[model samples]
Target: MKSLKLMALATLFSTGLHAQDRVKGFVYHDVNNNGRRDGKETGISKVAVSNGVQVTLTDEKGWYELPVGKDNGIFVIKPRGYKVPLNRDNLPKFYYLHKPQGSPATLEFKGVKPTGPLPESVDFALLPQQETDDYTALIFGDPQPYTARELEFFEKGIIREVAGIKGVAFGLSLGDLVGNDLNLHQPYIKAVKKIGLPWYNLIGNHDMNFDVKTDSLSDETYEANFGPANYAFNYGKVHYIILDDVLYPNPRSGKGYLGGFRKDQLDFVENDLKFVDKDKLVVLAFHIPLEHRNGDTFRSEDRQRLFDLLKDFPNTLSLSAHMHTQSQIFYGTAEGWRQEQPHHEYNAGTTSGDWYSGQLNEQGVPAATMRDGTPKGYAFIHFKGSQYVIDYKVAGKDKSYQIEVFHPKVVGHGKNTRAGIYANFFMGHQTNLVECRIDDGKWQKMTPVSAADPAYLAELHPWDTSEELLAGRRPTNATDSPHLWRTAIATDLPIGTHSIEVRAKDRYGRIHTQKSTYRIEKAKEL
Candidate 1:
């Protein structure tokens, strides 16, 4: 056969151009123009295809090459929108192992036993998405931790729960793979690889370092850690687009820290989907929530055009993190999303539930429950043909029913306020304020709210009982740990400008100050 490049050039021109021979193959959108890989049929074009060190874009035919090595290699780069299957260890589906007959080998995964036999082909299939079927996609907000110990709070439990539990075609985590410290990316990647399923990443607000200067500061560090931060892969009959939606406007001096996709990547998405079936479903995953950040005043202007573009797809389920709590939302011309209800619109839950804060359960697991009733856990999704279905399995105890929290809007600014003291808004509004005294002013004892409200247990799951859903908040302990939000009181100092100092004692014996501002507005204003 003539070289792929010669063939490509011959088919289109009079001059001969050599094919960049590495491994010539392609990934295409299986547009259901009915059972055939036709010439005129479109392919997933211009997506990134890499061979570990080098990266390139697939030509118009969705065809690509990266100097294939018969040994120690296979095809893999972010497949654009689709998700990749992670092994029980959580490593990606794209990797090559070159072992010389019975030589002691160093494994990429710490515990991945010798895979034994390598497969003949490592190809991924992408379905042209027209619309989603009877399915939904589960979304996680964030699981940012400043330290390694925190990753344990995630792996010891939630990581264990997700193994082989493959009902959904794929899964995703909102950004903040590590805190601002980029070094954690490797360990975090190695840790989550345990689930052993196809997964993708979303860029988030917390995923960047505000210290760097320039938009091009290159998340190359992030890229090396998580494989081209913005790439794609395929899963159960759908074209899932995983984007490095976070643009670090400046890393050196710190400038464009706002979260959104770049013009080039967005252009790639539009071009990549050229072969996608317009009527099929589209699964978009990134770190920053596409919706307004918790309380932003206007819709992101950048997303408006993207949203308009998304309308072309019959069904689209966009998942994001950043809020560090569980939230759900729907866009498009859908009725449920168009209407305003806390339940139908918001961010997804975080992986750590609350930065791995609070006391351990009877099982010695960190109590990771979101204020919205969901606890620290990963979402499960089932994708068949062109549809997706989502279900959340919270970490901690094995739950068969959805949790439900009943409480009125928080009242009064004092930690003693009824709702403020008992409400587990650790996932919504962080209300950890200190209560101080004026005399020789001894900071007295107070009721500190636990991120995982031990008492915040849902009296009943959403199925057994009903309640309004609210937006999610992130896990605290960003710098350290939020410890425990002990006990407190109002000090009853005639509602006006008053101040107080607060402290909390944790189950781990760690103590922290709850010193922050508090306004004693009329309770009726709640």
Candidate 2:
């Protein structure tokens, strides 16, 4: 009888410990705009809440319970037609960090402070908004500024242009927010806040704690600024999943980092998707591109795991940034994708183009054009229902400027000139159709070829051939651009000025037209 009583007591103790580990919360409509859930306020049902892994919905009374650890962030997955509260800086305050012991003291940057104990109730307040299916999101990739001067360049060159810009629902930066300094995170936030939209950030390899011994502790500084590195939410018909795929102290070398996900992160994605509808469009945003020209930068197993989790969802898109250059990468059956439609990963162009390199423009800002000949630009992702389209916007230029047309200044009439016309469509893909027209003539098809951009070559030549010292830094050597197209133009026309127009039908079926001038002059007498 004594031994049986001891066993029962032990079981009760274990059960009590489990009960303490669970967190209960309420999702209520803050009608008055105050955070508290007043007695007059009603509860919002079916709202999703998560502890960075498992997701649960609120009950009829807006009550929810989820398991959490000592170091966990309890956040609400902001539902469509409802918005979360924003802090003074317009940063969304949707999460509550529960770190009893707080971050490790050895880190150079500050992290979250210790919360003595769990609150009696962790409640999330949300306000209602009329959301339309068709909306635009400003997407920026790698505004990575290494120094204060570069940060100023970002503020003047990029932020100043988009200040007070309207119509964008929100903005997302695809990692590499700053170069190695974690202290600049706040400054970066202060600068980007002028855009007047809730900005979401992704953790990159550069934005990590290098002193940590394990991969899981790599994002202490990031987590301190931004609640959780891995989280998801819904807006309109799209579900957005932001992940921290940078694995520090790479298992192979134990020195540098690797691009991959941890098992817990994979589990979190799998668990989160269980609550999502398969028909909804799933957009995964991360830092490092899954594959490069050489090969896959991330681990195969981790990618396969994510693929397995996403197999049921037919409509999916991934966004990444790490490579200084930009291109479109498709992964089909050969790459272990199970769906008939290949997975499209858009490697977005950087805002801090080529790390703020190249000669200064009239505005005294670095030209900073990317090595691929694509201008430093940001992308606008327009979504309607489950469908989406991307539009690349060149900074300090008109919206209609999509392609750069490069050709010889003058060609001899009735003489076979070796010069050819090239078009560098900013967001062109293999499926895009590029055509050129000269002097109001019929459109002729331009062949897509992997070659160095003639325009970028011209930009680089002046720096190398200049006798005197240049005013600003010189751009890096050009690489073969995937979106470049070439076609030999006929010089056998009448001697006069001719207008050459280049039109491109992009993968989304949208047509873009650009025009340039070329002179057809008579042959020079030798």
Candidate 3:
């Protein structure tokens, strides 16, 4: 009888039906926030938990069971009104990584160390917090500090200004936290900790283990630092899904990485959304922009699959930050969007702006102006119930400074010169109205043009033209600015200093104005 029982147990284990094949855990309310469940602490029912791909809910007793793979991260989908404990760096401690075999030993930067065996029960604790429908979140793109010096630059240039900033719920970095050097991850964390918010991060192409052979292992180091490459959380009425869309060792050319999603990730997304209410606004964030560049920078089939999965959700938004330039891309029927209203993807500007290039400023930080003329800055997304409006805050500048007007310092009087006045509306879309007038004159509509920002060109010109080497690295060449507006300057104005006012009405029905002065001079005899 004992031999027969052993054989049956072996068969069940092989088929993944035995009790040993599954892991049990409890999602409980930690009344004391001690990071563990005690006798008095009780489990929370109906909370969603996942083992990477499959999602399961806790029972009435708050106990849950999930089939575990050899390597998987079991995490609780952070629900609204509940807060997770944070580490010293303010990174949320929500998930438990179960890698019994651990990461490969050959990896250069090091990954998760070997975790010998699974515990009898893994418990996660949550604390309650008050969250309102109207709140603000700080969003940063590509604080890609390549060296320790550059990291300090980020600290003084960006973080120093917003440190201890109030009225913000949390902060998120869209990725490339460090350049290609994974060793700098800890320093980057230390630098950002000054902001004093529960910081969240996404894995960018630069934050990968390039030495790995397969894409599955590319995020070993990243996972060690930031828990999971893909996870979901909730704040008020918004459901945010953060993903690792970078596919290293491009499957086609076997070279650099590309932007796409794996089958398992898509499956996780599909399963995760089942628990989300259709009325809630879903926000997806990743490192690379889904919008194509050059020839299909991102995989089309994968994008279509994602779109199909999101077809049921009426309210959705996606955020990306790879190009270093800021632009708004809309996906309509042509891009396989299933809804009547097109989807919007905001390719945000980077905080590291042009890789920390250009001459040093008064603060001894790099000018780091973006290639599109959008200043190096961060964004504040104000959320109310499911809607949001984004405002860009330029570093070391007042919030009211939104438009950069480019015009000659002086122009010949009554000359029909081609000297045009250009306004680089950092947050303006092509559909937004941009008007310009001279000294309280009639407001004339400025035509939108897909051309380079002359202001950025002027900044770039000195490096090449200067006889001696400049103080800092040269900024990259300017690309055609998508949010630029142009109008001919009325040189016929009275011959004195005249204030040129440019007002831009943004997509959210907010108007921003900036003024520049130029003198109309009399013609000099040649």
Listed per candidate, the RMSD to the true structure in angstroms reads: 15.1, 4.5, 4.5
Output the number of the lDDT-best candidate.
3
Estimate, for each residue in 1-526, the C-alpha lDDT of model 3 and write its tens digit: 9999998666445422343457799999999888989999999998989877778889999998987766778899888999989999999998988888899999999899887688899888989999999999999999999999999899999999999999999999999999989999999999889999999999999999999888878999998989889899999999999999999889878999889988778878998999999989899999999975533599888898999999999889999998999988889889988999899888888889999999988778999999999999999999998889999999889999999999999999998788899999998888999999999999999999999999999999999899998877889999999999999988887899999999999889999999999999996767
Ranking of predictions according to TM-score: 3, 2, 1
TM-score of each: 0.55, 0.93, 0.96
Query: What is the TM-score (0 to 1) of candidate 2?
Result: 0.93
Using TM-score as the measure, the top candidate is 3
lDDT of 1 at 243: 71
TM-score, candidate 3, is 0.96
Q: The CA-based lDDT of model 2 is what? A: 0.87
Q: For each candidate in the order shown, give its overall lDDT on alpha carbons.
A: 0.50, 0.87, 0.90
Residue 134 of candidate 2: its Cα lDDT? 94
User: lDDT by residue for model 2 over 1-526, one digit each (tens)?
Assistant: 9999887556334322223488898999999998888989988999889887678899998999987767788899999899999887777889988888888888888877877689989999999998888999999999998888999999998999998989999999999999989899989999999999988889888888888998878888898887789888889999999999888898768888888888778877987898889888999999998773343368888888888888999999999988777888889988878899999898999898888888887657898888889888799999998889988888889989999999999988888867899999989986689999998899999999898888988888889999988876789899999999989988888888889999999888889999998888888868
Q: What is the lDDT of residue 80 in candidate 3?
A: 90
10 residues in a row with least lDDT, candidate 3: 11-20
